[model samples]
Target: MPNDKNNKTELPRNPELTPPCGPVKGQYRKGISSYKGIPYAMPPLRERRFKAPEPMPPWEYLRDCLKPGHTALQMGGILVDSPGTYQMEGKSEDCLFLNVWTPATNPEERYPVYVFIHGGAFATGSGTEMMYDGTRMAQEGVVVVTINYRLGALGFLATHGLYEEAGTTGNYGLLDQIQALRWVQENIEAFGGDPEQVTLGGESAGAFSVTGLMLSPLAKGLFHQAIVESGSIFSIASFAPHNRGDLEKSMTNGQLLCETFGTRDTTEDLYKLRRIPGDVLAAVSMVKSDQSVTPKAFCFWPVYDGVVLPKDPVKALAQAEINPVKLLLGYNTNESSLFIKGHTNLGIYKMLCIEIFGPEKATAVMEHFPVDDDHTPLERMLEIYTHSAFVVGMVMMAKKYASLGEDVFFYNFDYDPAILKIVGLNTAHAMELPFIFGNGIGQHRATKISNLSWIMQSSWVNFIKTGNPNFKEEYKGQVLWPKFDPEKKDIMVFDTHLSNKALPYQEDLAFLEKIMFGNEESV
Candidate 1:
């Protein structure tokens, strides 16, 4: 087994079919564990572009997974260079890799598996980031699987002619996720996991991916439980103005862009794009620093293909047409504020006006969220923006899930780290990840505020073990987390200490409900 820079000895050598290539050790758990990066499908380079994932050929030798496998090409050519972020060293067309974390000696323990999908708006990110390390969760008696799939234009471009030639397009990334779940269903039992107890969990775009899976008929029964963090149902209006027609036009526009880059002879020219450098392909994304480029204003995402997605997730979740799965969902307190750091309050008023009344209806929007004498446009902008994105919309989703008679658990994570509090980004989006994963340990500034890692992780583990997360009887540190109810609207507010409440932002939530499920003007 290989050793890290710290001189700690790793696990034993790979035995060809075992999960651990060497004994796995981490900050949380000490055990023999193998980290395997098994490829479940063929690469999507060259002629495989815009097609569904194909199964990979079996290999006889042991795959060296002491470290993470290759990551998919990050959209916009932006490398995943963030500290504490998951990353991969290599890139490839055949990058359908899945990483496994299991307890070292449990070849027969039958642990519950937690399959995670990383989020970067479906454009950036890999399962390789250190924050997503499964060793800690595996030490807690669960196997963790994180995977890499196509992103950006490579994953989400949709074309009618392309679909006519290829069976599918615009959703190859999602299909890859589906195929990974299928692979787990067929093979996770060999890795000491109860495939039937699989829980699909993710954040941001990953959370959206979970919803997409819930809506797809192909994904039914592949998973039983879901944990959606931060991201709620994406309404078509929020994402785009038109439906499939807009997506088709976008794809054709992308083809035209490729043509401008001297590859428009035929569809074969599209496959030739693989030979291009990473930076060149990245240049095609629409999210520029200046944000002036046209073509695809927003790049990468699963478009609504009638056969696969059938309809938008918001419509599906509202109608109860989504696949039945027990759900645990939550959002942060100040999500949108993190992005617009220095904006004035007046800017907030302008944004609300634009969203509610549109550019033409800005006058009406100004009436609702007005600017104060002391606040700037950006300051007001931050408040309304955060509320619109994180607080209000997510509450609507929780309410919908609870109304359907499903066992839904909801939370409002208001624990802001000291650094965030300094910048006024209190409990912004994705801030709760470290706490849930126990990464909040050892930090004197943040850790002193609260220690919810054990509670949060254990709660998740208990949920995987049993459909409900009420582990009060089995675990001592656990708190009483009741299922959500429409009438009482009980919720868990995570702060310096956890507390139960009727509704954190009851009035604002009612406004969101009127927009999402009631007959009222759009927000």
Candidate 2:
């Protein structure tokens, strides 16, 4: 067996496979052997054409698997602004790859595997990003695999228009995830992982994907447990009926924009758009504040494609129609404060007026999330966008899933107070990730190691291993997180210390629900 002693050493033999992608590496303080950038499916470019993910053929020679695959298309703002160690320089349509980290190559040990799907609203992100390195988790005695599925125009372009022969329609990216899971089921044994003990996990859109997988017939028996951070099955970004109109509008706008950007010219003209350099495509696809909240800026979200997605995720979970997978789901304290659009000082009502009714109705929106002289416009703005967009929606989804009698765990991540102060982003969208992964990310990161990070990471690992999250140590320092019960209405608030607090804003959620359901009296 190869050395599994420290983070600096490399693994010994690959008698099971071909030449390694890079020298085997270790990470964190724990001993884990890692192989990066292994392809799981055929790329979705050119002739592959919106078809379901096809199997990746084995290589005649050993393929070095050290580096990560190219990230799918996304804006450079996120990746470039805070680039990390695993950042690949470029992207391509042929980017169907995955990475693995394991404690040992001994198949008999059969460690439980943790698969992380990255989030960029399904239009961006990759398994290769440094934020998702599996070395720390692997050192903790779990095998970790990160994957890159297609994204942007390549991944979710809704091929129903041209590829009727394909078994699936929209959500090629999701189908790619299914194929990756299938790869793990069949081949992870070779990497010292037990396929039977797979756990699927993600954040933001990635967490939303986890929820999607739980309901997917294609993903059944592929995973045993799930962890969702700062996101839920019914998050307001773009998954539900209210958002469907937006997606349709976005798609129509996207098609028109693509045509404007020269992506359409008969079926023959489509090739020119596809052939456009990625940077150019990325430039054209960028969603800016200047764009109208119309179809052109479509969020490129997942759809309820009957073949792959089957039904609305919430409806599936509500009726006990989904696969019987255990779940750990939660949202951050201030998710919207991180991604606030337009000026930071606008009041909530004004922002909503801009988002839903456009700038012309800014005065009218103030009637709903009206501002006062006492509160700053930023405060009012944060309240409006955060409440309607993320916070209230997450709480409702957690409650809906808990009502099902399944073992659903809920949390609110309010940690990283120090980092929040540093970055002026209070517990924002992806702050919990570096804490959980704990691989020492960017230079400006707040790094006085918190026991809370350890606690949450261990809880995630425990859920992956045993389908339960009560760690032996969790009860030692904090309030033991009770399983979500509808009657008690208990939820664990994960911050400096864990607490089983009654939800503080039930009435606000009620107000949002009334608005959604058209209870005009309440509204």
Candidate 3:
């Protein structure tokens, strides 16, 4: 990992700039000022475990905000430096830092700010993922902020011991995000950002966290707009430890985890869980996050603790109880293919439905996921998981927000190149990230691919700048994206030609809804 401890290394200095909180120096370029690893909260270790985040202690001396600090202790996933990808391991509990990319440092030029949360199934991922680079977005005239929050059991393990001590139970991770937003409101102006007009967004697990935040009363005034890419509690609930939250089950899981390490006493185990080395706890939590299905899949995720999240996220959004922020959400066409790496049979498919949708609805669910003669068994399996996990839930939320008269923009990303389709990840989960951030500047080898990415990138930043994603002038040959209407359900389909179409795959989604009863499993 890089030395991101606010080290006072001899580098090009931009003079000491003092803010309301502290004095920190950052590297300034011709048009932008960059700051990395700025602590927004004290590390969540030792006595701080399972508690709400505390403000970063103020410093008197000049602190160097240069490199990104340690990532919150996490098991490797697609977002981390993993074995299949890179080899860097950034795991630490002292990971409550936020990185800033700004166009100006002057307080007068208040720019629209976009704060991004990363996704890793709620157990992994770091904001420093190469694909989440904010330079291009900042250059497009919006201040960009990326944050890190605690993951795994450290973030979501709710228990009676915790409820008695802290009025709140689990959701320390969500609190970490709220605290970071508070820090932004307090300090972003010093870094050339308008805290008042912040837009919150993320992909997959980050998007799921965004869902939780939008529905959280504590996060009410912190953000003005939201952009959720490919996550929905209505769909993700299947992975939760319990659908409605069973304290007995939670206690049992905790007890077993303790017993695995030869600790039988519940009190002793709870204390040990808090006192053990950060990495050791993270390693244990990583192992537990997965179920019998796979090693990387997560079974432990966010829960509706009634305090942190008032109701199940699906119900909260459905009833218009969530924060009335400007909403933009969408899903990919082949989202499930990202998870379905191998072939499977009808028996396995039926078995998964029984586990996910329950036996009462499993047989009925198969009607929605029919195996057409033209499609392969693997394609059928991908469709079942994809539409169930992403498409239907996302569409339902957009309709809910639109019905409540909230400003909503919805889309369907099917802009898959031949290469992506050949690799079997055509418009798969998180595939739109590069296009949205325009992080593909150097990797592009073809004009068509470059042009598509440019349009997607401009649309995203434009939305951040004004809450409207339509950018026809700068990115020529791009179609206009209209506001989503529940009656018409005008969906923006992003392909070679960006066009508007009525909501697609409605019949299939309706069937899923009939059997699933609206996120019965998005745990």
Candidate 4:
């Protein structure tokens, strides 16, 4: 609304907005007003640990929302420099906070809202990451929100004890996310955002969370649109054998974790486990592994508890029992590049392949990606993972949605900026974040990176605004992004020279889909 000529009047330097919970004061900066560190749920501590989030109590006084709040207790440096370096301070179990950015805080104005979930393999990362700052995106006349949910063991640990206590278990982090969206639906109007026009999005684990939320009955009408970048329902299958709906494995792992603390899976032991320090719980749940290879062991993740996620993702998609939302989803060319590194010999590659796909299917799958003089075994393994973990599942989901007559847009991000190419990260996983957020592009003005950033930001904002990326007139003739056709499978390729074309690696994707989904018709 700040962009509208009729509403161009100067706003107060310090803005105050009253929502259902309380009155919060936010600061104005360069025409954009932001509220940071607003708690959407009560702190999950002591007896509340590992339980479903409860709504924060209403406050009578104006709360200071100037600085970012504590991130969910997590090991630092999972995606950055070192432990405690990314988020130096303010890491606590009491981290159910969210941040908002808006062009104006006038309750009369109704702008589209985008609530993004940060991803760090469901363990690390926070809403306040520098790359996730919403100021630039807020300039596009949209309200932007980012949030921090519980992570690692503090967020997801399923056991019989937890099941007895909460009637379900293992998705406390996801419950935190759902609570945040509820807060948006209840309070976004005060921040000049339309609760009915909310778009939920995320990357990596966050993307997984978005897809999980789509299948979750509890999260069903909270959002109407979704933007999933570089992750999907099948992404977690690479690490763990059970589907997201399966709780047996997660419960077994939870018991094992409790055993590590010299405790049992009884209700009494649950209290003892909760009494452990947050940092100690985070540290004990940490698993050290080589970044080059896909981890074979199980880690804490969302489970099909028949409550939050009522059905297995594959079954849910097959039954079409998901929240039907306009979807804009895609993946980068080399999604596995960030996770896989170092030289992979043929023996190691074969072993990894056998580990992922069974020995019976490994040889057949290996035939599709042969190591050659130009394509080393490492490159072949990376390609195998990129398709198995990211591409196949994403295409399956997109095709499923398109088949159901949902407005679906798909993309392939192939833009490899020279700076990243030099380091062998050519359009790797999460490389598109800075561009989508309109950050980290000032230094690359001389190249097409800035222009590509503009294209992405414009398309993303248009999608958030109208549920159609091509709704804007400027994209009418020059860049016509077409809707994904289930039969044709057209995808918008994001690069220096953008084009709409059929998805690449079709044969490979089909093969992987068969291996992953078998004879399952619905995917």
Q: Report the number of the highest-lDDT candidate.
A: 4
Q: Model 1 over residues 127-178: C-alpha lDDT tens digits?
A: 8777787777776677789999877667776654566566555788899999
RMSD value for candidate 2: 5.0
Off by over 4 Å in 4: 1-7, 76-78, 81-88, 241-245, 287-290, 293-298, 372-374, 443-447, 475-477, 519-523
Q: Candidate 1 overall Cα lDDT vs. reference?
A: 0.64
lDDT agreement with native, every candidate: 0.64, 0.64, 0.73, 0.83
Give model 4's TM-score versus the native structure.
0.94
Residue lDDT tens for model 2, 301-383: 56666667777665665567777767787777767666553455543335444554345444544665555787666666655
The true-versus-predicted C-alpha distance at residue 223 of model 3, in Å, is 0.2
Q: Number of the top candidate by TM-score? A: 4
Off by over 4 Å in 3: 1-16, 79-88, 241-252, 262-269, 287-298, 372-375, 442-446, 472-475, 518-523
lDDT by residue (tens digit), candidate 3, 233-287: 6665455524323344554555555556666534435576587666666665563
Tell me each candidate's RMSD, in Å, in order: 5.6, 5.0, 5.3, 2.3
Clashes of each: 25, 14, 8, 1
Candidate 4 — what's its lDDT?
0.83
Q: Which segments of candidate 1 are over 4 A away from where they belong? A: 1-29, 75-89, 235-246, 249-256, 259-278, 286-296, 344-364, 374-376, 391-393, 443-450, 473-479, 510-523
Better of 2 and 4 by TM-score: 4
Alpha carbon lDDT at 108, candidate 4: 79
